[model samples]
Target: MADVVNSRSRSSSPSSLGATEFKFPEGLVAHRENLPAGRVTATTLDGTLTKAPLQLIEDLSNGCGGQLWPAGIRLAKYFISRYRNGDELTGKRVIELGSGGGVTGLAIGLELDQIGGDIDEGGCEFWMTDMQAMMELMEKNVSFNGLQERIRCGLLDWADPLPEFVARRPVDIVLAADCVYFEPAFPLLEKTLCDIAGPDTEVLFCFKKRRRADMRFIKSIRKRFVMTEIKDEIYARESIYL
Candidate 1:
């Protein structure tokens, strides 16, 4: 999946943004006779933890949200790395926006379980949300991984009002990955962020830059939230070792 995305990022441009053209390669069946369940394994946390084999049903027949994208993979791993032993996330209320496959939210639960934390008792209260289009597959993944107790799924169009369950309490964190695609959604997403997150809510947004237009989304959000780039450690030697 990462290879396919890297190839697209290298080949595509704003004028020829084939974001919706992404699909499984011809004859490369995701499901075979041996694995008749039509599911695939995505090793999160660098293979330290494996999510239950997710049912691979990429309904690109409708839209691109059904497939797992690379940015979501990166964000999921980042959450796993940041929340080890559940120190910072023990009881915080978290909400993952554009949670296509619930990877990041599931990774948080898996990480809690990895470090001897009880997801049913000590895990962070988390909600994974996306537009109505992606609800079925997203909900299936949550149940497939046995995360019903730790995470909830809902329909969350950024332009619409916040769901009643989420608005009941102050959100502590907002997680989004690869959500900046269409230009029209920029303001809607920005508004949703401001509405859901309070002054203290931590927003972890991750996206691979596919076009200069992607900058527009950043510009709109900057007015409401102070932004900082998290540089890779290997490339930040001067800043780290200085």
Candidate 2:
């Protein structure tokens, strides 16, 4: 998988991205493979977000997104490193596309909570979106984090028009993780990303390349948006590969 933050796509130097403290069942090796099927419950982004860890439940009954993936962890940590105290996201409209278990967005809420008072008052609105099938798991995780009041979960099919909640205002930041896996859905993802991301919007896209076709999805969007790969500071980029 890869981590790309699209802000008009410049192929400059790989920016340094620090890692966060996390507790995984199988450590970093989990990303090289998929977890055994059934259900998984664990706390991720353990130390950084809050005193109580961000707990998540992974149920693959709906789709692969039901489980946590490398890009989600990387993107969440990268976001935390940059906006750990939650000041940058203040007043920004952030949305995570294809948020299977709402891991990334929920982790974000934990940071935004650092601002104190109601997160809504901070003018920072967060929406974790995915297909209808993933809503239950998403909502469950939101409740897991005690973030019901901080986040909103919605149905956002990439092939469909922007949901009313997202269409109502300008989306300042877009967080997408592991969205490039299925080649058949490339056009749909492209349309939706380009549709929602304005000239000034920031898009954080992270994915692990399961196949060469995933690069095709990347190329399709390069024409419209520049993709800059994030350089991981803790481990070599190759470490993410199996």
lDDT of each: 0.62, 0.69
Against the hidden reference, what TM-scores do the models get? Answer: 0.73, 0.79
Worst 10 contiguous positions by lDDT, candidate 1: 5-14
Task: Report residue 98 deviation for candidate 1 (angstroms).
Answer: 0.7
> How far off is model 2, as Cα RMSD?
10.2
Question: Tens-digit lDDT track for model 1 on 29-81?
Answer: 22222331223333433453554322233343334565555566567767776
Total residue pair clashes for candidate 2: 5
Error of 2 at 7 (Å): 39
Q: Over 4 Å off in model 2, which ranges?
A: 1-40, 114-121, 233-242
TM-score for predicted model 2 compared with the true structure: 0.79
Residues 1-242 of candidate 2 have per-residue lDDT tens digits of 22211121122111221223334332342352444443334443545555445555566777778777777776787887788653776777888899998768877777655422334577577889999999988987787667878788889999889989899888888999878878889999999998899988989987766688877877888889877767764433433321
The per-prediction CA RMSD against the true structure, in angstroms, equals 10.1, 10.2
What's the lDDT of the predicted structure labeled candidate 1? 0.62
